[model samples]
Target: MAGKLNEKVLLTGRQVFWQDTLQRLFAKEGWDFYVLTKDFPAPEEVFRIHNVPVVLYVLDSQAEPKSWAPELNEILAMCREHGVRRFYLLESLEMPEARLELSEKIASAWRGGEMTVSFLRLPEVYGPGAAPEDGLAADWLEASQRGESRTGFMETEEKREFLYADDGAYAIFRTIARDFAGESLDIVTGQPVSAKELARTIGEVTGKPLSLSVSEASFGGRLPDSSLVRAEIGWSPRYSLKDGLAMAYEALQDEGESWQRSARRDRRINQLRGWKEKLVPYAENLAGALLMVIVAYFQGGTTVNPAVYFDLNFAYIGAMGILYGKGQSLIAMVFSSVILLGVLLRAGANAVALMYMPEHLLHFVAYLFVAVVTGYFADARAFERQSNEWHAEQARERYDFLRSLYDECVVVKDRLYRQIVNSDDSIGRLYRIIRSLDSVATENLFTQAAGVTTQVMGVEDIAVYVLSKDGYYLRQKVRKGRLAFQQPRSLRVEEHDYLKNLIAEKNVYVNRELVKDTPDLAAPILYQGEAIGVVELFGLDFNKWSLYHQNLFSITMRLISASMGRAYQYEAEAQDKRYYSGTRILREEAFREILQELMERRRLQGEMPLGILKVSREGRSCEELDSICGKVTRNEDFLGEHQGGIYILLPDADEKVCNMVMERLAREGVTAVREEKML
Candidate 1:
């Protein structure tokens, strides 16, 4: 084996599980490894901090060659500046352009042959959380899992080359350490293991009978030959088909503690709980209004004018109902104005009919006055009914929103529990816990915001990104699910195709083309007071033109921008406090104390629950403080201070109870700032 190289390694791109496992394995063998994430601290900063002498580039098979080429060049330049003499390209599969371009770049950079470049191509890897069912083993395992027959692609009938994840990590380390004397190596066992035999092994391990049917269709695409790898790196897989299957089976059995599991549990609960129930009566009422309109159209009375009045009245009522349900005062006013105009016209026609009679005209005038009053009362009644229905709809919306908020809280709590268990260290761990907790809270808020967009603007997949000095970072503070951030290599925001077109024009760009070409782009997301992102929605019926859509988009944008602004201020203040504290001790301790104080004050002031508790120094637990605080406080005084003191402005509390509570807090050595007044 070659001696280990004294260098730090930076890993990036998809295959997080692979990267994480590699980092762990490398560290165990005394190699410094740093995992580069598309999240916080930015990409270039990762290079600046570690400045590793050797660069290992991991390429995914699906990545665009045009995009990857420039990125590779950038990484190469960075490596050159750091005095790196060697670059290694690790790939799962070969893409013609990516392989050719990368090799050409490496050769150009090493004109004198003083620098070395190597490529390691890996075969099918099987372990825990690994299988073709997951798309990585698309040629074999995935097909088998789907009960499809496949044929062997290789010319040899009994080709055998399979490696476990741990073994692969070990092999990579060994190859790098020796600086193997070859330009390319096949990291595979030369033994032939047929596709049929491998499927049977997996079936036996899973206890799920899988039939292997091999046909000409399966043998269409041949695996890239790795003869160069075998000759150069001296790499050979130790895990056979049976051994790899056994390990994978064990891993699959123990994969219950992942984020996917938690998400699945949540989805199941939502399906079974039956809690998003809407009041059926209001829906029925709207249906009835619609039915009336239909009936009025069919029932042509003695005169067409009377039938017209009935149709007009039905439409007027339905319009009022819709406006009321949406809580739009302007729409309701417009509807009422149209109906009043119709009534005035009808009255004027009746007056002209009674103009020739003397005795009969007096009776007609009296009836006309009575009809006008009746019309006024009828309009008032419709308004009242619509108003009541609106209130009911609002209540239903609020209930649904609260229920969603509760479910999200539960998920956040669970994530926090896992984070706490996996974390190590006091200050850093605590910071992580706080950050995670903040993220959970933020996700809930963003979800609510998304709900608002959906309800008001009929948009889906709303995402908010906060503008940062480096670029746009996901406002994880108000997001749901496993929020991931993507850092653009350049600071020019317009480079992104979607954002580029949106920012170029200062108005909402409705792309009919998006619906036809990219239907997924329909979900509208607002940012910086405009609709920055939108995806085409399915099953939308646009029968009428209404300003409500524009209003909804505008309002959603404003809300998101304001929320992002607030979240930015918060993160900024936190970073500032960390910077000014100087000593790590004072900074960390002060932060914790500040957090605890904020929690307590929020509890007293009935502010929204925002903090998580540490089970140990490293682990965090979500605190169910929603039940503790009956209502969220919107007041500023409770959140303004850095210390952990409760300030009560008790104007409504009973004097005796207030005094008693104050005395108890004092006894407990808790400071309280209070203003006493008679209730």
Candidate 2:
């Protein structure tokens, strides 16, 4: 359909449960929306169907990155090939660090390349098709309908932002309309709602009492700043949390009604089966008795010794006993006996005389013997048949239950297998990390460690310390965020013997003992099973301080350690290439690369200060100029020659420090100017 926006939008993902909502949202915004279903055609073929200018790849939170990342990369390549200008990645806020890592991996190749990729991070989304892990509103509504309590595996006090599916889709529409690109925008409400608050809201919406049981496990919430996106795109949620819950409750109510109708149909079928079982045996017994009565009436009603002549009746009794078991067969025997006595009375044989006669008594005894023996055996056979049927039913039920369990296990196995194969923290990610670190110089490993920790762990405050060769002290190499000013410059081994021993043993030392001045998390970078350096975190969210995060920290540190260890070995082999001959200053190319990385950090973090002092040679020799500048600059400074001028790169420096460095250089007969606007 042609609408306000002429460019078509293609929505695709690993799993697209909200396609309908998105379609509706796009329609309301007067844009053509085309959905690519499971049948993924060739990229060229897809373009033939709809020449779309924008592609929105919805990231499935339930799926492992490996399963979908390759496909996404292929699409990105296709977009670039076809001149698609705008591409959006819609992702969840759960495992934010993982999301960040995944986004980078997908967009790494296209950093400065074509086909701009933008990330739109969403909070927990709730709607009719929402899963339990994605949204709690649907779960609470269903529980309320069933009059049951839902168990939560997170702390009751933990609050998380929730967005409706329609609103989320609209956010995407707004981003496309506004042509937002080359930026990661978080689509959130900014206000986090707790479980208790949501539960109460659901109860109000459903008109049922809500009950929630919280466990010891805690969940971390990400408070993404969405103010910029809101201001830029002019978009906000149209529905409140309460209104969204009400709509979800209505959807659940419709589903419940459908389930009730199906249940009623099943109940009726079972009732018919019950009736067939009850009436079949009784009908057979009645027909057998009627046939026997008709035969006796025609054979001899007035004949003498009718009981003897009516011997066929005994056959009928045995057949009934075999067919209908003891109870029904006994009824048939009584009917036959009444018929025999009536015939004998009609033959003028007095009832008293007949009872006295030994022949008549023998007939009566014979009949009684036939009925009792057959009934007993028939009853036993019936019990055996019923026992077999009961066992079969039990076995069938057990088989169905086991089959269900097997299916569940298969699903879980496939999911776990994919995660192990392609997860952001899996072996593939580790390999990538090692490859990324392999290119870094050994002296810059600490800076790389801090950057990796921030991107992989989603924490800003980090510090890296290098162990001295004497093994008696640790000197801080780099510090980021507030940690730069919080911790000491150096730590003595003897002063923190407990922490030192733990680190030497290659174990992550958590601040569980509540040691004052200790970081929230600390781990050693091991080289050959010995501590070479330590990574410490001074600031961490209370919600994120869990065993899971601790384990993650440990694993990440080990990876960094491996990279550092490898870099150190390479550093020994490439010493001459890393620096100018006979000087501590780094080569120009090496210094520029490091500077570019620091500048990237400043752009991303928005706070790292960098100062560069440009010193003129004034017709002096290169070696003499280097010696004078090296003496005045600190060990942290980088001195490099660029365009026939010696430049000093001061990290973590302010305007005042840059001016001081300039003065020092001027006193050394080298006229230097502080480059206040360093890129």
Model 2 / residue 473 / CA error / Å: 82
| Residue-pair clashes, model 1 | 24
Model 1 lDDT per residue over 84-165, tens place: 6667777653345556556556535643333466676666566666645433332354454445655444443544456678
Model 2, poorest ten-residue lDDT window?
Answer: 301-310
Q: Assess every candidate by TM-score.
A: 0.36, 0.43
Q: For candidate 2, report its TM-score.
A: 0.43
User: In model 2, how large is the Cα lDDT of residue 65?
Assistant: 72
Writing each residue's lDDT as its tens digit, candidate 2 over 562-582 gives: 888788778667768877777
